[model samples]
Target: MATVTRTTRADAPERSRTEHTGGGLRGAVAAEWGKLWTTRTPYVCMAVGVGLTAVFAFYYGSIARINDEPVQAVGKAPIASVILLQFIVVVLAMTTVTSEYATGSIRTSLQWVPVRHRVQLAKAAVTGAVSFVGGVLLGVLGMAVAWVPFRGHASFETGEAVVQLLSIGTYLALVAVLSVGVAFVCRSAVGALASLFFLLAGLPFVLLGPGSEVLRKINDALPQSAGDHFMTGDGDPYPSLVGLLIVLSWAVAAHLIGLAVLRRRDA
Candidate 1:
């Protein structure tokens, strides 16, 4: 005699739900990734981002010998390049979400993956992963090329330089994720770009302007300041850990708010 056992959905509701959620998330991620790469925007953005980094790295290296301190050029090359490339990252991230809404594909997306949170998480994951990998490649390339000007000489500590490279890559990726969240909240490419410009470009300048010491302290908490601190190895306003936490907190808060809004609204 043989006994056969079969599990029913009601009998294992928790397990069933967990499996369903996991499957849905994977499907959503794959779908988002496929959608993202199927177009030319991501490719163009990546090319521009890395291309600009290469240009800046070459420029820095070319002038490295002219400066009184050539080591400063080596240290600044990679990070400075990334700072300029961040705008492209912002546009890429914003377009990822806004394009869907613009084409009215969002309704179909919602229909396919009814779980709004999963969709949002999938998009964020793709954006973050792509940006992080691109940033790392760009940073490494910039550093390698910048070293050409130094002729193997250095003014900065090797350990710190290595740390800064990793930090800059991380900062760029975080910025991309933050931009993705902002795009979700804005739900429009133009609006999101305006918001990103204010947050990434305008705010830092305004905060850094001649003002009270209190304003300077507040400026340290801004995302650009955090990125600058990581880039320049400046631990004055906030420690590396604190600066990362500040940026990460903003990213998390933005995503949470966007998710809540997505859940409440129609596609």
Candidate 2:
């Protein structure tokens, strides 16, 4: 008879545990980065965003030129593009989380990582970094495209343009983080998108439309308004620093809530 050997059940769990801990946070992040690029969603989102920005920039530039707007700042030329790009960024970030849930691949992800918080952190890091870079590039591209129609109508200040580009990057990174957190909480793309839409656009409009001082004050404190003030370097109701803090606070709050939910919920 041939000799036979059987592995004990205990050995199986030990091997699994070792495999689970081997990857850790670094591995999780690498995996997330891979997932982000391997899919078509990121590419689609980026292409659509770039196309929309170019179109909007040209339109805005033409309008400014036609109106003979007096030397509008180049930094402000991309404002319209930024508004539309926010939705694109949010969709991209949310998909990172929601897509996995939609396809039931989140279970496999959890199995590989085995640490929920690490998974969340990895997703946040990847999305935030990608959004920041995209935002900066889009800002520069928007300005360049708009300048075609705004050759004589726009004023360019290197310092101001740099500040605006950096601000756009910072704002989009935070917005990406906020969208990721919301995705984890909702676990459905439509649900998360609706919630973010209200927070980023609809609520601001409703509050501002009322034309009440209290409502206006509340709107100013929202993430969208705060981001606007920070990016534009506005100092009307509050300083830029305060505006940044407000946006940061919203991002942090959403992340914490999502983390808590991830810990308690089933994958």
Q: Largest lDDT belongs to which candidate? A: 2
Scored by CA lDDT, what does every candidate get?
0.81, 0.91
Top candidate by TM-score: 2
Residue 244 lDDT (model 2): 96
Q: What does the lDDT read for residue 212 in candidate 1?
A: 72
**Model 2 ranges with Cα > 4 A deviation:** 1-22
Among all windows of 10 consecutive residues in model 1, the one with the lowest summed lDDT is: 66-75
Query: Which digits, one per residue and each the tens of the lDDT, describe model 1 over residues 94-128?
Result: 78889988999999999988988888888888888
Please give, for residues 120-144, the per-residue lDDT of candidate 2 as tens digits.
Answer: 9899999999999999999999999
Clashes of each: 0, 0
**Candidate 2 local distance difference test against the native:** 0.91
